[model samples]
Target: MKLSLKKFIKHFGVLVIGILCMSAGVALSKLSLLGTSPISSIPNVISNITAIPIGQLTIAFIFILVLLEAVVLRRQFSWQNLLQLIPGSLFGWFIDAFVRFFHSLPNQTYIEQLGLVLMGTVLLSLGVFLEVNSHAIIMPGEGLPNAIALMHQLKFAKVKVYNDFILIGISLVLALSFTHSLAGVREGTLIAAFLTGRLVNFFTEHANRFVDWMTPATDANN
Candidate 1:
């Protein structure tokens, strides 16, 4: 039982780390003055219109999106899925709160800029690792890509291309309609997907090692 408890704690530790990483990624997106992922983009739009923090908007948006997913994908619901939102939203809120404290330090150099990019990479990987491992509910936007892959019987990579392109188009439309700064959409969309894929791959490679290490040893003694 103690072993089980310890394992559980370890799993949760990964999750906690993952959430913090995700939050950091979000904060980086804001700092880049570029737009964010589709989910975040919609929230950004709402934030601009309402003068609300992006995190608050994202939380509310996530809730609605999850509720919609529950309705659409009833049989897919699992503890991992349902519980995931807690960490995700909490991380977002925390990052948002921290973002309030600092915009950026003045007189930063190219090395600092590189460091921020790496920070974003780490956070994106960690968040995605937790997200995939949670085996719980995936965020609606992420889930959508998976669903498309399943329905079309295609590779996730291929489906993701379609999913992201569609989202980018939608974001463009919304940005134009609302007259939000076009910089985020113009600059952020495709680059985010590419970088996120690389980061997620790194996360998965590490996770695979962890999973292998944690697998119970088999023996005939029992």
Candidate 2:
């Protein structure tokens, strides 16, 4: 029992670190001032036009995504999916906190902004890898895709790619419709979109050693 508890704690630790990485990724992406990640572009654009906090917007958006998952999943949606709200909400708040932490960062040149995009993508990828490996609840950003993959019997990687593209497209429409030009959908957003899914897959393949060290043998059962 003690060993099981210890393993459980390590599992939770992995999830916590994963969430922090993702939050920092989102914050750094925003701080780039070029654009944010695709999953964040809609909230970031809405935040820009409405002057509301992106984190708060993110909470509402995540709620909507969870609902959509229910719709897509229909009979398959379960209490476990609902459990995602806890981490998802915390994920939003974490983003707000990290954004504030880097709020004082000075403006950067185009190259420097791109550099942040690369770094943020790396963090997002690692976050995603750890999150999946931890075998815990996922934020709706990842959860929705997982649902789609399960429902449609599609490859998770391919579904994730499609999901990312769809989100970027929707965010582009929102930015154009509301802002009448552009907002958070930009080159940096494109960079993140291009890199995130691929990078995540890369980490899942190559970075398993670290995650395995942190993960318990019976993690799959838990």
Candidate 3:
């Protein structure tokens, strides 16, 4: 679909807000001291084991996904796909900044920690929905599954689940091998994995209404 200048600006604004929310969600989840989202678990674990910043690892992980997509869908991959790096890098920086911001908050109780995880889940879901609906650029985490689904002619949802499971497995292996236990994959991660997709769908179903409400009357009339 072609976007008018007004619509393009709206979409771009939503996309940026979504990325900020997603980064904040990740930071909150980490602050909960429970676990992060499945996509971020490996990076969190590695960051803990090594001295590398999670943000830098996140960017590296995104590029690795890009490379994997190219390898698996060589015929379909284009240089345009590398454009994901732009937003992905921005997301990584946001994650670092938000993590620092949230680190100052205290989660002193189990209930408080759980609350943080739940809040993070909602923000993460809304962020994903907005980002997907914006149709601006796809994050590498999402793009990998999309590329695989297209290349294999499979369903996107199922492929996404498989992709998440693979990441969870890798996170488990890395955590166990390096940390001698599960570090970043825990109950909260499991909760996020199970609920995030459904929550995204729920938000996506209502996003149109929200956008309509946000659109100025002049734009609507035009």
Candidate 1, which segments miss by more than 4 Å at Cα?
1-3, 75-81, 106-118, 133-140, 148-154, 203-208, 214-222
The digit string of per-residue lDDT tens for model 2 on 164-203 reads 7888888888889988877777888888888877887888
What tens-digit string does per-residue lDDT give for candidate 3 at 8-83? Answer: 7876788889888888888888788788898888888888899687888999999999999899889788987998
Error of model 3, residue 27, in angstroms: 0.6
The reply for model 3, stretches above 4 Å from the true place, is 1-4, 211-222
Query: Which one wins by TM-score: 1 or 2?
Result: 2
- Would you give me the overall lDDT of model 2? 0.83
User: lDDT per model, in order?
Assistant: 0.63, 0.83, 0.84
Task: Please report the TM-score between candidate 2 and the true structure.
Answer: 0.90
lDDT of 1 at 65: 56
| Per-candidate clash tally | 5, 0, 0
lDDT (C-alpha) at residue 168 in model 3: 91
